[model samples]
Target: MSATATDTKTLLGIALASGGYACFALQDALVKWLVETYEVPQILFMRSLVIVLITGTLAAHFRHPSILTSKYRGTLVLRAALMLFAWLLFYNSAKVMGLAELTTLYFSAPIMVVFLSILFLKEKVGAGRWLACFGGFAGMVIAANPTHSPNLIPALMCIIAGFFWACSTILIRLVSKTETTLTQMWATSLLFGIACAVTFPWIWKTPDLMGWALMIGLGLIATIGQYLLYEGFRHAPASALAPVEYTGLVWAFIYGYLIWADIPASNVFVGAFIIVASSLVLVAWERRSIRLAEKAAPI
Candidate 1:
């Protein structure tokens, strides 16, 4: 493909990624509201059920029903399991932490992804990327203000959730090489639904009309978010889009203020600025490296 086509595809990926993160922020706000009245498993069971139904329908329409028997099933299951663990940790923490704090802590995932790539994918890490990682963690520490945080355990859980999320993201990039988006969505949703079902009966609460609507809404938002993010990865390298992930923080702060009347502390702003700067530095460094390599290639 020509340079123009590649640039267009990358632009589309960034757009999709931004939209996906916005949907996720909305989903998180919805989850925060619902969790006040329902158990995490109950909420996730419904959310996963909707995703399964939607993805299942798409799979049928597309006539691509071979996901379960795919050669990459093991990796897919592992990805699903990591996401399940991540969500459980995230939503549980959400019940205690404000959205701004919750999101800032979880925004550590992109930084973690860079390091995970080095470890699992055997990707080379430059000095610049190393410095970016250091800067990102410093920002996390600054934003967290662990000494001052009242909900220390929940804050830690949110950070751990970010780590698990990063693992699943790496898996998604790996399997995207061979799997259709529908195939990935179907497999992940099926396994996620089954796992949520295991403890769902014990924690189940019959939903009122609003409760049902919100839970289903959560599912719909999640489906759109998942589809958008998956497609984004298809078009752009993860490095190209890492900075786009920060857009969720903007949405998180907006929703938090609008829905809950929550305002962030000064430290949160400082920390967020640092984190976003670090990620941007990493992206810029990656682009410079790519350009230099292209220039040096033999004719």
Candidate 2:
């Protein structure tokens, strides 16, 4: 393939990945609002239900093959399990944590992705990418000031959720090699819906019209976000796209301030500046590496 084509794909990946995170930020904001009035399982069940219904209906229109016949069924199941586990821990933790702090902790998943890609995908990560990931993490910490967390256990849960999420992300990249986006979406959402359904009845509360609307909206956002993210992995290496996850932190802060009226300290601005700078540096580094590789290739 031509270098121009390769660059275009990478750029598309970055754009999709960044948009996925933005959708997630919106989801987190919505979940934070809903969790105050509803149980986690109930909320997740509703969200998953909507995703499954949408994906299932679209399957025929999109000509998606049977999930049962997928060669990577095992990996898809594992990824769904990991994702369900992560969401449970994360939303439970959301009860006590601020959106800024919650997303800041979860951003650890991207850093984990950079290393996991090396180990699992056998992708060679450059030192510059490593430094940028860490640097972004540090900036997020500075911005979030999680020292103010009202409860330590919930904070820890958020971090653990990040680990599970990181594993799920790697599996997404792995399965993307063979799976259609709709297939993965249907499989994961079906499994997720079933798991949440098992516990949903115990905590079921009939939502008000508003509650129903919000949860449905959450599911719609999640569908778009998941589709974009899966498409992104299809086009770009996980390690190269990992640092772009930091951009979510910026969106989290924006949403936190807008909806919750959580004000940022001066440190927030400083940290955000660092985060942006580091992400830009990583983009530049990736382009340079791609160019050098193209030059070294024989005609």
Candidate 3:
């Protein structure tokens, strides 16, 4: 591709990724609102139902029915469990924490994914990237302000949620090598749907009209957001798209302020800047490593 064409694709990827994150931020706001009146299981069950229907329908229409079949059933189940738990923690934390602060803290997922990649995938990590990981953690602590009694529990929840999310992300990358994206989506929805179904009887609540609207909106928005995320990676290199994910933080801040009147403190911005810079550095380092590897290969 020409340089101009490449730049255009990159811009499109960034836009798609930014739009996806904005959708996710909106979903988070909805989840926070729903959790105020409904149990987490209730919300998850309804939401996962929607995901299953949408993903299943898309898979049947665009691909073969067998695309829903997976050889990595064990991995898919594990990933689904991890994702379910991660969202549970996130939703619970969102109930009491400022959205911007919670999101900034949760944005630690990419940094955590780096460390997890080294541990599980046996990927090499440079010293600089390792340092960036620590810097990101330090930023997380600053943003979380765990010393404050009220913030401690929610901060810890968000941290653990970030770790789980990182693990799930790494699993997705590994599985995506062999599995279709639609298959991955189907598996997550199927497994999580079963998990939610098991708990639904105990926590089920009758939804009023607004509650029903939010529940359906949650599913549609989440599925579209996920599709946009996939489209982003399809259009551009992940390194080029990573920075776009930070747009979620911007959306979180905006949504939080408008919906809940939540104003993030000064430390939140400082910490978010540190975390974002460190993440971008890691992405740059990874991209350089890939280029070096390609050059080193003999034709």
lDDT, each prediction: 0.80, 0.86, 0.73
Clashing pairs in 1: none
lDDT comparing candidate 1 with the true structure: 0.80
Decoy 3 TM-score against native: 0.75
Total backbone clashes of model 3? 0
Q: Please, what is the TM-score per model?
A: 0.82, 0.93, 0.75
lDDT of 2 by residue, 26-141 (tens): 99889888988998888888888888888888886888888899899999999999999899999998777875688688888889998899999998888878878888888888
Query: What value does the lDDT take at residue 298 in candidate 3?
Result: 64
Worst ten in a row by lDDT for model 2: 2-11
For lDDT, the strongest prediction is: 2
What candidate 2 gets wrong by more than 4 Å, as runs, is: 1-7, 98-101, 148-152, 297-299
Error of 1 at 44 (Å): 0.9
The root-mean-square deviation over C-alpha atoms between each candidate and the true structure, in angstroms, is 3.5, 2.0, 4.8
User: Which residue pairs show backbone clashes in model 2?
Assistant: none
Model 1 misplaced regions, further than 4 Å? 1-12, 96-105, 124-156, 270-299
Task: Estimate, for each residue in 39-116, the C-alpha lDDT of model 3 and write its tens digit.
Answer: 998888888889889888877888744633667778888889999999989888878886546766787786667767
User: 2 or 3, which is superior by TM-score?
Assistant: 2
Q: Per-residue error at 65 for model 2, in Å?
A: 1.7
